[model samples]
Target chain A: MRSLTAPRRDPAPSRLSYRLQRLALTPMVRVAVRRGLPLLALLLVLAVLLGDADRRAVLTDRIADLRMQIQQRDEFMVHEIRIDGASDLVAAEIGRALALDLPVSSFDLDLEALYDGVARLDAVSRTDLRVRPGGVLEVRVVQRVPAAIWRGPTGLHLLDADGARVALLPRRADRPELPLLAGEGAERAVPEALRILDAARPIAGRIRGLTRMGERRWDVVLDNGQRILLPRADPVPALERVVALDAARDLLDRDVAAVDMRNPARPTLRLGAATALRLRNIKLTELGVD
Target chain B: MTDLYQSQRAMRAMRRAAMQRGVIAILDVGTSKIACLVLRFDGPDAFRPSEGVGPMAGQSAFRVIGAATTRSRGVRFGEVSAMQETERAIRTVVQAAQKAAQLRVDHVIACVAGGDPRSYGLAGQVELEQDHVSEQDVARVLAACDMPPIGEGREVLHAQPVNFALDHRSGLNDPRGQAGQMLACDMHLLTVDGTTLANLIHCVKRCDLELAGLASSAYVSGISSLVEDEQELGAACIDIGGGATGVSIFMKKHMIYADSVRLGGDHVTSDISKGLQVPLARAEWLKTRHGGVVATGMDDREMIELGGESGDWERDRRSASRAELIGIMRPRVEEILEEVRARLDAAGFDALRSQQIVLTGGTSQIPGLDGLAPRILGQQVRIGRPLRVSGLPEKATGAAFASAVGLCLFAANPQDEWWDFEIPMDRYPARSLRRAVKWFKDNW
Candidate 1:
């Protein structure tokens, strides 16, 4: 007799599982499930995290804190400022102008603002600022050289060749070697004044300074109170002619109050009052009318 | 008849669509197992023919990309007896094949093994209207063939134009562009039980697959197992499957006749099961491992362990001699071969020019079948295996996969069937646009 038992298990898959397997084998469905699912999950996570305003603020704050921590590292600190090509006073002035505390983070140091501040100093002509490695702020400066002195109503100020003011002088002896310019707008015409002084080097011992008359012409004053009024167009040539006359005839040694050469074609001399009375008596005696 | 032609034409169209998609499936619903093969068509220009090589038996056109087989259930005599169980089996096999191929195949070409196929020879003659025979004349000649009374509840599986002859010149393979007065042709028609065909189509449909093409198992097995010259001359293929034996005769590379016997290796296994008082599973194992048709003195000395799972240890330990196993299997194998012989004789296979008979299928693997087949089948009987196709798994290149491999070849390059040719415009009804167009052309 056959034994009563259950039948063997079938190896075939159920209809549902079979269809599911076929569905999974489809290329479009497989790619969607395999690749698209993970990407979608990542995007969903990102969206969820970024959708809340509080969470967004926290993320931004965290990023900013991280940046601040990196910026505050000791490696990025600027300890000392090395100012080059500046005199002692200008260097001190530049340091005071920048007003940056040492050992401050270089990231906090605005080089452009600092450069503009240092350049604003009357003594500094061009400034370059950079935060070098190893905690050093290097301030490279080009200082303006005093080319002439202008004695204005306020005081005497030192001016560069381009008529750019460099510094102030307390007295005229402070820069004795420099040529002096006095009167209004003299600082603007310092180049022309320096050229006239250059032409009057023949009487350099007798010349005192130059005065800009009416802000147009120049009057070259000698130490003996004699003055030569120069034409405005070419004052250097007029000054050169006066120097030649003084050299040939000792014209500057006589009692002439002023020599007027405003017109290059003609010349005039104004005598002093005492010299004029003496010259009239000498002329009457010579003509026999005592 | 028109319904059959239209259905066949629809299937051919489906096949063309599958070919354009580059992938199709081959299914063999056998009794013992249902096999599925995924074939990728690379087209004709995919590979260059070698210096001395041809198309390699038409196997070069396609490659076996995926293959799967499952133990058949709810199937008997190669027909689905239990619908639900068979559907599950098909789903399992098709899913596995798709998994292996990593592709979803929507089109399938299936073969039926136990459909009780019957073959008929039809002849017709027509007078050529023009000096030269055109394609219309060929279609007219084919349409002139009278339909045989194939009886009720039967459907035609294959209707192939076998021979075309012009007047005074017979054996003309192509009558087109030939100067002939009378054009005669012979066509081969194979029909099977209508319900069986319906069952197969419904089964494939349930699996969400379109039936692109349908072939008789006997006809396809012959296509795979028979060599080129054998097919070119004449041959017969006897496929000894599980529940049915398929017998097909081929002449001039066309299946001239096809039939099936409803007896096969399953009956032999049942005979062994009954004779040895063993279970069907154990009987099947014995049939494959040690079964043979010819028993000798050495077979008697060889003993096989016929172990049983019964609780009684004595019954479980029982053994049988190889000769006894062979004794139970020989008669059934002879009966199947005799049935095949009767089929061949009835089809007048002996009248062909060459009388080569090839034995194939799952049961043909018996060790002594080569020795026993000659006595029943002719003197030229040979046990054959399927043709070698590219990328076929080594395990599936056996006699049992003959029909599956042939289905691949059929999917790649199908022979011209009657529906493949266009019908004469006059054959259409008066309402058809083609008839009106032809009318205008003739008058103008």
Candidate 2:
């Protein structure tokens, strides 16, 4: 009795589907599903990939291999080293102290550690290490000028103005042009000794060297074995006073054994033993008792 | 009575909440179609002064963002006859509108066109205690009105104060702060069947919507279809709906009377169906396509094919002239209009300064209704369409959507009602704390 070919369909949604569509359209829910789900999935994937110890180790190894490849590029590899402002002997010493293998990558080279190593060389005062553009580690070294040669009980050594030991010498004759210093702590007083030598320049030709007495004062010795005992304080001015007396009265040319200017207020000269007995006989003849 | 008062106040508070939230839905549950409109309140301050748009009758306060309409099911005489079927229809329209808006609407303002609305006029007078009238005096005057027996199983839907008079001077819109000895007020109260109202509330609740406000469709259609001057000068709006014809009288911009007739366009369609021996669907199609209130000489020559799905060749291949269809529809349309005219006459519409009558709603689209309406409703009848609101779809701007558009304007700026005013102090319990406070203020 009814026409069933084209049935009327209900367009109204079911309660469940209606509620679900509303839930999906909710702003908070929509944003969570849109943005938060992908980020959470990414984190889950990363966690799965990196969970095993073997995989982690392989990943780190790959990273290290990649780093090595970048470091070993042609532009980064160090092929040569140049040391400036140093003698060949000091240069070789610095090279040995550095101990870097040749043709190593500049990335593998720790310039700060190499700088510390090269700076510790006894002959170097200051050293700068830098990898230049041409794959070279250029070390610009300022060699320590031996301001004074210290003669110790062990051997002879070169001393700089700041009283730092530069290098050991074979003998005193090897560096005869340098002023010599001798005492227990004579290297520590190199600058003061040099200053005393500067003030004693008036008797420059006759000066042999300066010795540190009690490691506090300087004893200036001449070529004739005559000594000037300088004071502990203001030794340079005291030495200058001794040089002024020697220049004015030819004090050192006479038979003076030593000049003691230790108190700075009084300058006492001790005559030689023979010259002292002759001076006493002259005094006795003058007093009429021969 | 106080229970319903409190509930109405609660609904007003919900409306405020919806406004604060900036989005509310308008549901017009008519006999033939259920329309849902999503309104987004941008507030009055959203408009700039230079835009040249002032808040014109509160229309500028909100915009219609989404609109949808669906053929109503299981409804008769504008009232839901089948609960599940009506609920499904509501869900369909609300879902479509929400989809268009891309928003979730929780609060709704709905209009009811069925429910057998009845109007009452009440007047009360009170001697002014002080020389100048105060808000409390106005409240006391409204409270002093004599209560009429509105009959059992009926609930008051709208109780609006329509007019106020100070001393001998009448027609005072607001007597507050005015020097007067006697304050007299006129109130308009509209009531609908309690069971029908409750059924509507339950139906909306079943669709997961909170009813923020409920209004009679007759009142709201009058609000949208009648122009400002027409309302000011007193006019009657006849809304010819599918199963009911709503009649409302507006005077001084307030609805003074409202009633609904039980006859409407569906009766005309049934008449056509019985006269031509066609299905209701085909009859409805013929009524809309070739129907007219005033048939002409040319209509007899134009044949309208009444297509059918019946297997019989004679039943399937049938034809009728446009004049025959018009003849079948005109008597029923005249009957609905005569009923509306009788209701208007009973409401003393003839005594008003203006006898303007506006015919609107789905059935008002019948061809040549304007020519036929004036014969029954008077010589001043004219068909009206709903006022244009911003962002409303072109298809929804018809006379059928008059109540829907009026619901939008109502949500933006609702009229003051009896419950909106504070209860008179004497009505409070004797030992109430506020009463004690009032006593302390008066004697101190």
Candidate 3:
């Protein structure tokens, strides 16, 4: 209901609140204040809360523990090595070459480097290394086959058909049945020397060994103290021709100390000591000029 | 007609938009200070069954995320006097609050005072469309309420259906989903000076903001300051502001009547300035620091020095006793209280079962007002502050922010108004004459 009394009225008045308002933080003032003082206060509080060394140590220990647990999981830890396709000697050499401690974590093992190292042994041609289940590390080794014996200054080394060294022996008698090669580069022409040995199998009883000539050719030696010079290129064909002549005329059995076949087109033979002496006396008497 | 519809639509749209965004700002535009508070509303999904039991029923849970208050300017007696200046001031506090909240808000629900708001109770009855009364029946009953003849230069600010009666059963709050042949409603309508609202709307618009909703500061102050029991029974909240004292009566959790006494804290300051012959600023400081109505025997010995650098020796060193300062402030405060008492009495406040009176607002800080208010207003008086809200700045959560906080409650659980529903165009057939009759019967 409307009343007779008017609301007691007054003129508007200005206030001291304005001065108080001026002291308040406007965004403009807050920007500067936050940069200088308030920001530092906030950071100081945070430092007090988070900079405790005890908490840091606990956190760091927890992180290290987690890392170790991941690394030492049982799924792939390599406790032992299983070798396949290897003889006892080859496996022993490979074990020495590997140089790994048993019961090692598989994560720490470098399988590629292990394969290369184990395969570089004299008896091993290739290797397959893997960490199988049940914490076992398996090394599959393939040992090279010895094709011939090479008499080097170091020792009597067994060689494969490709002239790679397989193993070292104490003496030549250790492998008497294998054909032997002696010289600086005899290992380099192992295939050619083996081919020559095959061609002279018809006189196998008289054959001794093959020697390298300046790394360019081969000289076949006989137990009868004869030597045959073989050409470097096409040495197999030249040796085949010698075998043909030996089959037709028993050329290898005559008293010839040396048959030089370096020039395939012209063949020559040096007489033995007795044959040369008898031939010299007859020629001197006939010519009366000795 | 279109203006009313459009304005109502605009307000409703803003409510929708604010609800969709789940955050809005409440602004209390007063003479002494302008306050802005940003509220974060947890949406419908955020409500708990435990929530529906309080005074804030069906209200979204909200927190005061940002708050900023500054000295008001270009406003007198709770009305904007200078357009540009008020716009700038509104922009200032709103921007500051937005910065604090780290968000931009377009919707604001504002509260104003000293707008000459008038309240009237209108009754209506309508035939139900079906056996089971629906929301439409309630709407029809409210529409059937006679729109009275409020004079020129006045606008309807609030139209809330205070009570509803269905057929044989009366005192029904909601008739929906109930079988009834007849529906009835008792609606309370409030109107204010049209220019007072237009000025605020234009000022808000000039600030490049939307006028989402507007409320009477007196009504909102009661909403936040009065306790649940006080509101449920009968109580009045007297908000003694800077330029005006706002008075509102509430019963059953709704405002039944509201009036304003246009003298407030500033008047007391003026009295001190005139009595002591000091600057207005110094008088305010004295009022806040040393002014009080309840003078003790030792008050005669306590002296306040008025120091100044004006270079006038006698004026610079003048001193006054605390008793003398209280002597000057008490009368203006008493006059405002007496005026509020008269208005409350005229509203039949004493006839209500509970006549508890609550004093809140900036000026309510005067010491001994609780004792002084009871004797002068002749009621059970108590000083009230707004209920606590989360994250509210320590300073802003005081009694001065009652209306600002109340605006948040009003925005959260806004009492449904007539404009929210579609009214038949012909329903307002007897608008002016009936309103004149109602006004004459109530006042004369």
Best by DockQ: 1
**Deviating ranges (above 4 Å) for candidate 3:** A1-290, B43-60, B422-444
Q: Write the per-residue lDDT of candidate 2 for residues B99-132, one digit (tens) a residue.
A: 9998888899999899999999999999988999
The structural similarity of chain B in model 3 to the true chain B, as TM-score, is: 0.91
- Pitting candidate 1 against candidate 3, the one with the higher lDDT is 1
lDDT of 2 by residue, A1-290 (tens): 69968878887767676667667767888899999999999999999999999999999999999999998999999999998889999988988988988999987898888989988877889988899998999999998888888888778888889888899999888888898888777888777888888887778888888988987888999988999999999998888888888789999999999999998787899999999999999999999996
Residues forming the 10-long window of minimal summed lDDT in candidate 1 chain B? B46-55
DockQ of 1: 0.52
Q: What fraction of the native interface does candidate 2 get right in terms of contacts?
A: 0.27
Q: Estimate each model's TM-score.
A: 0.70, 0.73, 0.60
Q: Which candidate, 1 or 3, would have the higher DockQ against the true structure?
A: 1
Model 3: share of true interface contacts reproduced: 0.00
Candidate 2: residue A129 lDDT (0-100): 86
State the displacement of the C-alpha of residue B176, model 1, in Å, after optimal TM-score superposition.
Answer: 4.2
Residue-level lDDT tens digits of model 3 in B1-444: 347656967897897798688778888889999999988888656544432123254334776778988788889999999876787788778777876886667788888797888899899999977898776677688778887888898888888888888777876666679987888888888888889999998877765567789889999999989988998998999999999889999988888888888889999999998899898989999999998888888999999997755667988999999999999988888898999989998999989999799999999999878879989877688999986555578898789999998898888888878888655434555777866665686589
Q: Against the correct fold, how does model 2 do in TM-score? A: 0.73
All candidates: DockQ: 0.52, 0.32, 0.02
